[model samples]
Target: MAARLPLDLDPPVRQLRALLLGVDDRELIAPTPCPGWSVATLLDHLMSLAEAFTEAARRGADAGGDRPPRPPSAAHLSPHWRSRLPVRLEELATAWHAPVAWRGLARAGGITMPAPEMGVVAANELVMHGWDLARATGQDFAVDPRVLAALVPFLSAAPAEGTPGFLGPRVPIDPEEDEWPRALGLAGRDPAWRPPRSHDVPTVRRGSREQPPAARRA
Candidate 1:
């Protein structure tokens, strides 16, 4: 397994923080690529994950088997989230910067695993969700190539199609496409997916609205 480097995480953390800070109240209620989560709900989830992973770093591998706290809900949104989340993101990044955090095992959600592997998982979550928010709000999202390369192995190992909590069936992509599209494709997201437009809704054909003559005769 490829070990995650602390520097590999820095860009995504910074990007996610910038994205979160740019969100306005009107955008908070918007739906994201995450099936059931709105922008606000996703932010809450990120905050909880950051806190849990930070604690995991502090506790290290030998800290007895204890699970991280449950992720917070959309209702947990507060006036301070815009300020608080960035601070938490920084804390998460800083904690992992310690070389010791990458050695040995780490406990998260009561499961102890190699610290480096968990770090990759955290990085994947941050980058993918950053895309989710950007796509939802019509903002440009670009991941650093180094970060994308680091995450490729993890994306390649994603669960098979139809797995719960994952995006729909994987969308095949041309190898010639850009790195981000290829990465998104392997991660089960459609590289071409765009937010639905109100005018794009399906319309009934004029004559098709009535039963066909063949059906009436039958």
Candidate 2:
């Protein structure tokens, strides 16, 4: 049998990091696609989720414990958040690189599941929220097919109305839609919906394949 490919968090991580670098402090208060979550709030949530998933990779089932997660807010954001969040996210990608991180069971967001499954959830959070930030701040966003490939199976099995609190209701789309729109729709985001300032985003490849001249080997 062929070896199952290790789920790569680095690609999504790099995309998010690039978006993070461009965010201005003035834009922190801008509203994201997630209801009531500002860019600052979402960035804080990303930092916390990164920490949680990295711990899941390190400690397996013992990671999240039983503490109720505090609701994410801009107030929880540190003055140094611009630097801190990316570092934490980088560590998240690094932790998952260990083979043992993908074995046994893991816990995150106060729920436990197989480590492999949780890893997919982590990637989903990255890409989905990456879209949230880019849209909120009126920036272009790109995603690699491999990242969506890891998420397709799980999203395909998700409920039609979507999971409350985790994801909202499904957005309708045409039957022949490509994987990108399909993925967003399954995650309860409207593919056609745009922010007041949103425009056609110039494409930037978020893959590990041929990259822009300045793209780092992430």
Which predicted model would earn the best lDDT? 2
Query: For every model in order, what is the number of clashing pairs?
Result: 0, 0
Clash-forming residue pairs, model 1: none
Stretches of candidate 1 exceeding 4 Å from the true structure: 1-7, 62-72, 162-169, 198-218
lDDT, candidate 2, 1-218, per-residue tens: 54454698999899899998888788898888898888999988988898999999999999988886778989998888878888999999989988888999999878999998999998999999999988877667778888888787888888988886677787877879998988898898877655554365433433325454455445
Compared with the true structure, what per-residue lDDT tens digits does model 1 show for residues 110-151?
668888887887787788888988877767788988878878
RMSD of each: 10.1, 6.8
| Candidate 2's TM-score | 0.86
List ranges where model 2 is wrong by over 4 Å: 1-5, 197-218
lDDT of 2 at 218: 53
Colliding residue pairs in candidate 2: none
The best candidate by TM-score is 2
